[model samples]
Target: MVSNLAGGRRPRSGVEPGTQLGALEAYAAQAHGYLTAGDDELSQLAGLLRPLILESWLRGVRAGIDPMDPGSERGLRGADLARYRDAHAIAPLLPLIDKLLVQDTARTGLIVVVADQFGRVLWIHGNPEQVAVATEMGVREGDDLSERRVGANAVGLVVRTGRAVWVHGPEHFLHRMHQLTGAAAPLHDPDGRLVGVLMLAGGGRVAKPEILALVKATATAAEMDLLLTAMRAVQPAPRDPAPVADGPLGLDVLGLGQPQLSKGGERIPLSQRHAEILLLLAEHGEGLGADHLALLLDDTDLDNGTIRAAMSRLRTVVGAALIGSRPYRLRAHIATDVEALRAALDSGDVESALQLYAGPVLPRSTAPGIVDLRDELRVRLRTAVLRSGDAAVLRRWTAGADGRDDAGAWVAYRATVDRDSTLYAQIEAKIRVLDRRLGADATRMQRSRS
Candidate 1:
């Protein structure tokens, strides 16, 4: 059957309730009443009116009608077009709009309309013939047909007020939308934030449950994906720094708070050289053998005998932390599964990655080789974070900054600042000082080489 929409009056601009918002409010109240009464059938019935509402909202704009005011049934007149407020003229939903393109068997020749939480249509699927009729009705993508001023229809009514609604045929205030039946439901986040709307419209009689189920299922899946992505954006890495002690250097290997350098919580102080060595090796995941560590210190004057003496003193200072088998190694048995850690990061499972990197790399002693390896890995990790350029990485690098000896933190800050000015301005005053220090260090190193 040919749609009755063609004979309906085109909207006039200055008409009161020119926009579809008023109609949307009315329908929303009705839907809410149905829900409050525990009338599931009526609630489902209300849910079927979304598509026409969306269509009307869009058409109201093109006709220069006040999008929030009900337009006149009278023919379009220049004097009538003056009431356009353009205030509540937010655009229609777009994300779920494309789904309206496909025809579903459950709702014979139905036109589907889905929108994102922001009221943008995303998918519009429907039968080709029904779509053609809808096109004649001015129901289409890139159109915001809200029922607020455009009068009663499904999408506008449900989404504007975050309620489910159904508007069938002549019940739509605008005579233009009388031939179509529409059902709409609001899409919401876990926190009950409205994210979008799912709608169906057709020329045939509405199949309440079948259409409702389809719209609900689509909304649920989209919400799940949205939540997962949002959660991953802010999760922090899981690593706790070692606590301070007066006696031996304390390093926490198990990631628990137990102190390896003290007995009964009493402090013991190690010599400055021993403390430096312990800190360096503990930061390096790979064991730094004695000889390579000696090179890192540039201590060519020290013989193997002297290095052995230092190792012995370091062991005595932190005996409890000694786990590795070799004299050159910090702890006798620090181990990790690099493959597993990397896999977790690659799979976008950052929580697992943080869990896997939980403990200190080494806990007993520090060697030059270990220090160099740690530095290299730190650089690698920073570069990886820079490449991602995500919001979290930028925040982390910002917090890592201190007055001095924060080269890694400074580098990351600089890398992200140009792209994100708010972060850049916060660290701007400190950037110059860091650059000068770094430059001087570079010059000194070059002079030493020559």
Candidate 2:
């Protein structure tokens, strides 16, 4: 028998020992009532829930989800499901997952569920009876079990927190899900990107600490299998003109925070200035001369020699051949997160584009060009999303840090939703908050003027 981590059935801190279930149920009831009634006092009553669980409930409420609804609201179906499965990166790991977990899950009367990074259940296996029950509850393949769709669950919570978690009984936001318990862990590709979540789900009896450990171990094994598979698939390249780094060059510069470059699974650290230069060069595939680059690099006039010295240092850090000198361009193809985001946007794949855009481009950069590029990309992406008039997409944007303060997105979201809906009320509240903030700012400005 597995020992309970929080001393039994209570997955979070600050709960009374014997009243864990009661507390969770009470909190869930309070949250439900507050959301349904559009009361802002929910936060005051959230003391019974763990911070993470409470946050998940708030997100669900903001999304206008009905806790009583039994089915998932979005997912791929039939032919679409088939196509997605075939193209998914996790496809190769399914057999390995089956070998490791299916028999055990079947015997234990548990369901093994695999979901993509976005929380869409791609596959489920286990005892036929349990599978049927889960299917009836909308846990079948192709159903979106994301927090925004079906409230908190092991799969969605793991994706959201990027950690192993167990959601038991009343910890679930949806009333119908109170009958089930789940433990899940997020899986990552070799490059450290989230691939999906691997979960073990059953009744409340499955909430033991050992079960969480088992799910984590299984997730690790599957990730190792994926990594080994990826390694075997890559053929040896004969030789390169320049000294090649171990793996492909990957650059991530979306956020001002911790921009990184990886080569052969090793991190090559960059100075703030070098990061700015590389980002500028990557953005301008056609290449820029030293003078032009210097101008972009700083607002004031910078000498050509200063720019040349910086480029020389950068070449030494990367390879000399990788940085071409004539027009100043990268010789080899470098994969960048920003370019991927742009490609997705250009292809009209707004969801993909949003997923790829982690944050603004080198957000910390004070350089004129980098700042302009960042703003331009942000504006263009928002314009495209608003133009599409997709409520789901708009909600996703408004829910993120970048869009939380965006009054335009709130207006757009409100316009797209029905006025009588809970979602409309939520957006209206957000708009009111924005209005109050704007009013305060205007008042301050008037006082300053006087």
Candidate 3:
């Protein structure tokens, strides 16, 4: 059913709500034509859209999303969904969510949607009529609401932009979606990591400015509840150290440097062994067994006593409550430098991502898990830099600690940089030196094989 937002009323421009919406709907329709042609940078498109929406359009174009037929391309159901939902960080706050927001949205003609960082709908609730209306628009539970699925939506834009926003009629890439307006806010943990999103979708009733404020307020409350729950779960050890945040602790182990943890602005130094254990725990948020951790920590036959001794020392430093017993897991929230870098890359902010890369994760650590993590982070970051194809970005990357010796990156730099410049000679020299070094290594390997 088409919403009554835009009909026979000749919408006049100004600050009036209906007038602005009508004008936006007209701009969106005009923009939609340019979008389908895969050209978001047309000179004619400038000043016709808000900066944020324009940015999202660029991302959608790069992702090859078909604006004309944007449907949710992925979802989960039944047992698989149950397992994933239960394991999600937002799982614990389900009750708080229901009590705080769900109860009120019922029969109110507004549907509440809670989505994970990836824009997968984890929970959706509201009036049956509204629910049915939403279901017809492909906003069902487990559906992926990301740009790749349904272009230019509030949830997708929030996930990409990491900020709260309201998507008005016609602003959505799907023409049929013009019937609904969606307001959404990102929920964050203590360390500023995106935990999830809270959103409300409807028609004229949703156009109220208060709806956006309501979503933001509820999101804040939800985050507070998460903090409280994490705090309540702590079992601080007898030897009291400085008080840390109640939820997961902030872990900083990027590059070839000493690992650190934090309680807000206060930095806590961590021993190498402690960092390794903490890294493993953070990697496996669900939990890890003693036997499994031992294997990841070393190839040698490591005994439980050694692992116990390490845990004992770690518990004393971070407090026992931060590390759960049983199958070991990090009880507090862990905000890592690695996570921040990935978030930047996800949002298509390669420059910020490059700035966050100090080096490979734990560049000096030889532990199996740390080594794997270092390679994974380095490769991911390198790939993102290469894919960016921005000459300035390539220049910045090739000069960094991680990419200084990266011959492939230097080659890419040469391709992008001007041949008429003095820097051209320097880049060429560096590439040749790297190529020679690589040639020597390959020749040595061939001789060894013979």
Candidate 4:
């Protein structure tokens, strides 16, 4: 970042030691007025407002968003809103957010806000009265608080710069928001993609340093949860992919090709249904019952009889000695290609993981469990590959079935290779074709709005 990025010789709004709150707010209001009125004395404004806030104010001015008027801003509502948030990658980690932020703020008058990378608020929980106050300031669920949409605010600042930020009182461009303060930090997925933002806001003590610290900590916890969830596929299964003499088993469920089993060093043929069951069993050591398998094996939820029949046939093929009753788990310890992929990922061996990832697991299987597992594995490997920034690994992935049409992978590949190389032009051609499909997600993931 530029030394003068935040204006007053530092990239922040440095409050002087012992500066009164009233004085700071007065100076902040003056700076906001200057920016709104098209004042060019940036040096004077820089002394009062933060460089980040000034930048946001400039964009707000360029967009012609009046400081006196919030203008009309709408977000997903009702079922559209529910469906969107449920489908989001952040959906699984809401519980973690609750434990880390909301519960502790019960009596603090602070409200927690979770917003997609687009700055659209997805969830808001806090003290009832404070929540209502936030709602009055347009911090309700489904509202867009992006820099371009709502000017300078913690959520908007985090979106613009992908960092933890705070917006106190008069720092907000809209007059209505001057009653509260907010601190927000970006929440990223396992692969380092910014998925959303976590924030805390209130009318009291919201500007305290601990507030930003807490927001940053909670955001980190959320990212770690994403990583752990991705790693859950790595249960207690033996790391060795080869079948061992200790009554161990092996299963291969990746690729567009048929899934197979390896027993006593001999490849064994298996039906698609059998493959799905074994893969699920291998990933889940504790095993699953027919009733549970019924839901996972099909969208319509197969009957107990059908699930029993499939398990019965599977038992015979793999030998009953290798299988158990009741929950119907594999009696012998097992290793799988999926586990190997996770090992590669866990060790940060992105290249090895890329090499092991021949394709998505049982790509043709419509079984719900298999689909979720497929996505988990694919997403982990893909995230690792992109973050690795290894040209060869990226090239290999782009050549594979899954990555061939992956626009994001191609774009990352473009960055790692020589700009003047023939390969660069080739990647460019590929990106152009897939560019339209690249960023139709969460409003503004590909680029932060001004």
Candidate 5:
């Protein structure tokens, strides 16, 4: 396939006005194999082959035919006519040659062309003297003289070699085409694979140095155009995430949490009761109705009054600023709309969810049940980000979590991003600064690696 960057940088395809072929001229003939069935089919087929007939006449001088004389003809039947027709069909691609043949009667020349990708004649152009030389070798405008079509000629050779080449007359490996000269360059995809060839042919003025440059330039342009066309047909890859704070979510919980969060950062302090409520909700990310929540508490002691009060207080603290309403429910952000949270997690959109679940589920609240939920949700979110293969998002999430100062998470984040093990010791050292147990484990991990 072609790369998207090949447009506008290619050259133009036009032959020089006084251009002449030199020693590099190569006459490569492709086999013409046409099958004949019925008279009607043959006539229809010949009609389709008419353009090639005209192109043949244009390049026929080299084959000992008169271009101006309508009556002068070569009695080609099935096979020869097919080859002739195919070559002429490709001749139009040689815009210069095609225009000369159509508009200029005095211009005598021979042009070399190849199939774009399918092995058809690409073009043919020339003055009279040049045309005569081309004809002798069956170098017509629409010839399918591809390497696979014939054996070795300037056309096939350039395609076969996958590079630029020049062949003059007998230089052709095939004796059938020993009367022409050709200079050609290979066409390629963005990946640099050869796609086709551009060739110039004429027997009159042999081996002109400028012709080589012209042919190379033309081929380069054609290749670029082909590549551009190919690139337009392909789709691009997905874009990577932007920087953390500048992101839509404002924070990514892919790896570790931000170790710092102040009043300016909208940081919230967790109260014992708020923390307890959050832990419970984080534990059950699944729904828990008010009745179910009351059961978890000592409702009998206060006739459900105590339970309702706890729920009210939890709402006022957790969703207070976010929802701005009483009865907003505890663990409301994470416990409610559980489906959206799960989807976001499954789709690797945890970074977005982290910001949604920001400010703790129930700040400063703590209960046995709440602690379980909080720890569970934290672990689940952590695991999901790691699986997503985006450690940075995980780091951001961890930075905002209770483990913002946790060394294990930081080391893991760094290790995932850098793919290095040497940082394990540093991670353990940092963890030791926060928690002795983690520091010991970190040391063990580093020793294991060593």
Candidate 6:
């Protein structure tokens, strides 16, 4: 007999179908009510889900996600989307994925979603009818399926735990996602680093142990394909030579407050000192000698041993081959967030630049080199935005955490925008606050002068 697996409970042998269905329905109702009421302590409630699912739900609630909202966070689009897809290391494996999973799953009333390690969906394919349903549920290309945004699901969970997961109806944290089931497995590169997640999602009928097994098998095949591709792509080259190709050694320093290196789809964390060194090396494509690097690091009193020791430690994480020691340079073509922001600004794309600027780079770092680099980037980006004279851009900049206290940006916004506009009132209020603070400062200065 076909058993209902909606509540993640397998029917016991010889249990009456009517009785089992009734129990499942009652359990789902209770769980839904408990979650809707914002009560996270599921231990007190009987007939709830497994501990893993409960924990995921609690995290979702803490992230301030609305269980009723099906919309996922959207990321890249248009030309930017195209460029990202083309540059992604997984691009070559997509066709193989479509043939092995998407084509077959579409006919089986299921959808195949391929998300990056960060939980941004790059591709969504399925039968026409099911695709429409998925879109209506806010599942689309570029949607961020990260746990912080979309709550618990196969994609987010697999990325989070680096393990295969089967989320059945009501097992999902979001109430709107209760009608669907998802089985996802994390795809790892040849080095065993997670590259992305492969997910198979369908309605209640498809949630089963066998489905999870199939997903795991498919994920394994995709990993092997990726491994083979990488192997074929690599070629021997001269030592300490400039990168032959624009590889995927992407560095993100903005907003992260610490640098994150993205290589072969894996995010490699870097120490503050390491981040400063990498940024310096990337900025100076010609390379910086050990002595030069030491000076930049504000270690003038120390010798080359200190720089060499730090570089030696960084080599283990970023690969020795990627770091050339002759003059201390990045052997790979490193892409940086700062470069992207600059490019946007250079092309008169103030809005694009603002979007690219996540925040001040390595905000807390007091290292001399880092401080100079950070301040230069922040000042340049802000100057370009203010100079744009676009009220919309100014308004967006002022609304951000960094720009909220920027009195000049607010003043520019006020002058550029229509006085009678609704946003003007908000800007004026901020201006008034700034004026009061300035007045108080002037008063204090007068007392100090006395």
lDDT (Cα atoms) of all candidates against the true structure? 0.46, 0.73, 0.72, 0.74, 0.43, 0.71
Badly placed stretches (over 4 Å) of model 6 are 1-28, 39-47, 70-73, 237-450
Candidate 5, residue 171: how far the Cα is off, in Å: 1.5
Query: Per-residue lDDT tens digits of candidate 1, residues 88-169?
Result: 1112222333343233442467777754433334445666777768756656553445443355567766755566666666
Highest TM-score, which number? 3
How large is the C-alpha RMSD of every model relative to the true structure? 27.6, 17.9, 14.1, 12.6, 30.1, 20.3
Instruction: List, residue by residue over 1-450, the lDDT tens digit for candidate 3.
Output: 212234544233223333367656767667676556544233333334555665566556655666666454345666556665777778888788788777887768788999986677888889778888887788888776766557788998887667888887777877768788898999998667776898988885676677888888889988998888778877854432334574445888877678999865677899888888998898777676675576467634266689899999999987776787667887666888877987897888889988888777877776756755675567677788888888989888877876787766777778887898888989888876764654433222222221
Q: Worst 10-residue stretch by lDDT in candidate 6?
A: 441-450
Candidate 2 CA-lDDT value: 0.73
Please identify which of the two predictions, 1 or 5, would achieve the higher TM-score against the true structure: 1
Candidates sorted on TM-score, descending: 3, 2, 6, 4, 1, 5
Segments in model 2 whose C-alpha atoms lie over 4 Å from true places: 1-23, 72-74, 236-450
- Against the true structure, what is each candidate's TM-score? 0.31, 0.53, 0.55, 0.50, 0.30, 0.51
Candidate 4 stretches greater than 4 Å from native: 1-12, 16-20, 39-44, 71-73, 234-450
Judged by whole-model lDDT over C-alpha atoms, candidate 4 comes out at 0.74
Error of 3 at 44 (Å): 2.8
Clashing pairs in 6: none
TM-score, structure 1 vs. true: 0.31
* Candidate 2 displacement at residue 157 in angstroms: 1.7
